[model samples]
Target: MPAVQEVEVVVAHRERATLRVGDMFLKIDADPERADVEVQAMAIAPVPTPEVIWRKPHVLALAALPGRALGRLGEPSAASSTAWAAAGAAVRTLHDAPLPPWPGRSLEELAARLDGECEWLVTNGVLPVDLVTRNRHVAEAALRPWKPVFTHGDLQITHVFVDGDEVTGVLDWSEACRGDGLFDLATLTLGHEEHLGDVVAGYGADVDLDVIRAWWSLRSLLAIRWLVQHGFDPSSPGCEVDVLRARM
Candidate 1:
């Protein structure tokens, strides 16, 4: 026990905590033994390509930055143009970074799991396969010729930070993977069109927009399957249906 300190939890599904070391800052995650020491080692490793920057579990000694996330950056008006640009470029930088081998099951494996969920639900007559099949196909195809690269598995407005067209840092890498840059781009652009516009303009990167859209469409359907399986208020309407329907 290296003198236990205060544990501050962050928003998101996984358990993450920030510890106070007398006058120092240390981040800790749940581990059975020598967690602090291990995190310290990870922190010293070259920050895993920018995309996984958010996903790694490490204790860094860097100052936090200013500005809010893209979602909270306030509606896309005059005031947010710079923030918008920065968010997009930051994500681009992340996707451009070379990646190390990711440690989870491949995207295809995950998508197959989603299909299993869909099959189980439809078999039980919970939801129509027609409701999810179109999107599921999109998801499968996106993973089919997967080109592994640094990717922010979850690229949402809320996960990005900004400071006048410059990303001081990107947060939340727990879902990071070495996957298609197009996949990451599609994930961010799917729901938030405004953000997508800004990102395209800011990054000025060549991405197969169609491929991104396909994956985006598929992810939505997968989400619906998860919601239904987890008992998350079935009556609750979600954008998955709209995205899936439009594609079909």
Candidate 2:
């Protein structure tokens, strides 16, 4: 008799779903284009990524990464500083690679989206007006023009995996595009501010700390609504709400 593989739903929402069955992941996206982007981005990214086993119209299968995730949003990372630094170095390599063919959200697009999301947040009473206003002001600092690079647009900590001091793999490439490098930096350190130095040390570049901070606020503010609709809790300790509160 063969051992039964347990099916685990890694994430699920209206748009997409990821399932883990033993050592393989099955990604089901509403849009096949997103899966196409994921495949292409993984192929071109300099960093390690999950191996693509196969793909259908809306479903893609991939081999699971070997190591645990870097960390979760609402939890402290037990991963070593060396592991964090290794993730940063791998990110730097990805950023230095040739720009992907697709473009990321432009400054105007992001600013407009920020405005709309903020309005919705206030009108729906999802967050305090004062809190929304304060973070909106901070978010302005991240709206400035910048040279584009190959960026993993959603570089969440959970998406990066590490084994000891080495970054074993990075996941989720549908959002990859040419965008600000610091946005990736900010996203990686979003809920885990204490490890910023370790990441910067490995990035080995002079970055504007203020800009990264601005991005932290901006990304959090922009994410809250989507997170809520997607059944995620942003107000948990060490999560998005805390990241915004830390700025205040």
Candidate 3:
């Protein structure tokens, strides 16, 4: 008998759907199903959060991501632009959704968390001297007075799943926080300006795009700083991150 492997299936970016391997067959790139809320929301106007179909001891809930990431879709054009627009719309819906106050930590707190971790690594001699860079300052500066809407701290094309020109899913909610929405938007916009423009155009509101860019730049530096501290040689596979830093 093939021993069953217990695995939390990575059905989306930064999220896993826990399931018994023996019960359901699985495969990569399989659009298992539009998460329950997704299907209902598509039918109705506002989508409720997905309900937990199964629960293990102490485990709360689980959901899967459907469709493909915008980045994985090659070549930017009208089609890609439309896809970006749909993705933006989906994000807007999530942003507009009224959820209970995430009364835990703020962006500054999270940035500080990153700093604490980095500092610890540096102090422990596990990080390089340049690990603490000017980036942390930038991130700290970016955290300012604003309406703290829900923020998906790690916003990117990979975290967004699209079907054709429609956004079927917004994957990853672990970094969800009550903070500046632009921070999330900026994280999405950091490298891809064209796509970012498409997103903004789709947003079509009085949103401050500059704030998003600033946040993006700050997060970019933070990412680079963390990477450097982890000791990836900039001249090796690390050159790409350095390139991104240069762009920032």
Candidate 4:
């Protein structure tokens, strides 16, 4: 066997750290319960996901997927429209799978959280009050009830990997639970709106574009505070702040 390689930090913060070693990724999470949920979610997801290598008290190791990420948060995607469509199909498969035993955030919980985040944004003057108020109204549409589906609660573009026009794998299942299907779609295309048509077409279902747009505002508004506190620049082009600005 080859000698174990040196590990490189992929991402790190107080909450969690991910390290890459040769063909494997070791995720050291602050919350072991989240790690357990990630492991179980990966086991039951219908779409292709990283192969689990092993698990310990606070660490979970997985084999790297075959392809590169579909896109980064603040960068243009080089992936073709077909690859975006393939990601949509993969999400459809995940949603069609039996609901996970765990529950996701309720509409009330999401609203309460969004309210608090909005208040924080105003209090800190992170963004103009008018912009926050406008987007808050837009976000209200997404608060309505819907039939629950198995959702990859955090389907950020970078988590979906693709090779050519095929979706090779998806990553990060800690937030996986029964939730609104549109939330997954919206999260996947958050800042990458140009690809929405392709993703919707591949989903093979008619979706409410209004609700999707609402989620864009809702997600962006809720994320800015966390992104800022975590040392991420939400004002970068194609990032959460930019997404909010586009709505104005």
Candidate 5:
């Protein structure tokens, strides 16, 4: 008889839940379209991604990748500089690939979202008014026009896996779409500012440092409310709140 595997709840909130049983991860999203995007994105992405085992309605099953996550948002990554570079190279490949059919958020839409989020942050007293104002000003730099590229829109550190300085797989493709390449770069190096140079080296391209800093503030501001509602702590050390605080 085979041994029964334990089911670990990887993540859960109102809209989605992920369960891990043995080597299989089952992601259940309330929106089936998100799962659809994930499967299709993995199929078309140039970089390595998790294997799709099966799908049913809003639930998607994936086979485990071979390595540990590059790092967590609030923690220092133990991955070597080479590994971080490899992740960067992989991102560059993804950005250079054919654009996804879907269009990403427009500048107007992003600006509106930023404005709304900033209001919420201050009105609710979630953050100091000065901090919110400073980041809002900084976020303005990233609202300019940008050419679209295939982007892993939510390239959080936990999504990239590494083994022995090699990128084994990238995960969480539900947010993939045609968007700004620099946005992806900024997202990868968000909390880990020290690794930006290494990532750019692997990316093998010169990019605007100011724009990346703008994105750091922008993304952090846009994320705090959602994180709090979702039972996450954006204020934790080295996380989104700290990212905004640094901008102050």
Candidate 6:
């Protein structure tokens, strides 16, 4: 066999690290449980997912999906509208599958967490009081009862892979669980609002745009502090902060 190749660090932080070596990707997490969850989620997911190559303790090795990411957050997507629609159809397939064995955060739990995050934002002066207040109200629309379905808990655009207008795979399954399908929709279109119509068209069902908007606000509010603490610039143009500001 050829000499083992060196790994390239794809991303590294305190909580996790991802490395790429040729066609294989390795993810090392601080928590073994998260790795376990990811493996299980991929095993049961209805759509295409990276093939698990092996696992050892906190590290997982997977064969890479055969395409590039659909897009990145806080940036305009180069993918065609047809590719966006294919992603939507893929998400619909996941949602229509039998619910995962584990449950996700409940509406009440999410609301309470959102309330706490809002308080932190205000208390720390991370955002203007009026901005938080207005968005908090908008966020409430997502707190209502929702029928649970299998959700890719963090369905950001960056995690979706596309090749020639087809979704080749979806990545990051540690957060997968039974949750609101619309939440996944909102997560996919977080900062890419212009693509919502195409995604909804491919979903082949009517969606409540208000609720999706509500999740946009709620998700952005809850994520800002964590992003800041992690040394990320959430305030960058087209980022989470920009998403919140657009609500004004």
Better of 3 and 5 by lDDT: 5
User: Which residue ranges in model 4 land beyond 4 Å of their true spot?
Assistant: 1-6
Q: Write the per-residue lDDT of candidate 2 for residues 161-248, one digit (tens) a residue.
A: 9998999999999999999999999999998889999999999899999999999999999999999999999998998989888888
> TM-score ranking from best to worst?
2, 5, 4, 6, 1, 3
> In candidate 1, how many clashes are counted?
3
lDDT of 1 at 37: 33
lDDT (Cα, 0-100) at 234 in candidate 5 = 94
Superior by TM-score: candidate 4 or candidate 5: 5
TM-score (C-alpha) between model 3 and the true structure: 0.62
Q: For residue 118, give model 3's deviation from the true position in Å.
A: 6.8
lDDT tens digits, residues 13-127, model 5?
9999999998999999999999989999999999999989999998999999998998888899999999999989999999889998888889999999999999999999999
Per-candidate TM vs. native?
Answer: 0.66, 0.98, 0.62, 0.97, 0.98, 0.96
Query: Judged by lDDT against the true structure, how good is candidate 6?
Result: 0.92
Per-residue lDDT tens digits of candidate 1, residues 1-248?
A: 67666644333223445543343334445542334333332343233212212324444332343554555212333326666766667666666665645443476687677777667757877556776676666666676666676666667665565555555555545466566777666665555555567667777777666677777766765666565554443333324555566576
Candidate 6 lDDT at 52 equals 94
Q: Residue-wise lDDT of candidate 6 within 142-246, one digit each (tens)?
A: 999989999999999989999989999999899998999999999999999999999999888899999999999999999998888877888888988888888
Provide the overall lDDT of each model, using Cα atoms, as 2-decimal numbers.
0.56, 0.93, 0.53, 0.93, 0.93, 0.92
Runs in model 3 deviating more than 4 A are 1-52, 58-66, 72-79, 107-111, 114-141, 221-244
lDDT value, residue 227 of candidate 6 = 86
Q: Identify the candidate with maximal lDDT.
A: 2
Better of 2 and 6 by lDDT: 2
Off by over 4 Å in 1: 1-64, 72-82, 101-104, 124-127, 225-242, 246-248
lDDT of 3 by residue, 18-88 (tens): 34243332322223232332233333333222333443332334344455666621233334788887767
How many Å off is the CA of 76 in candidate 1? Answer: 7.9
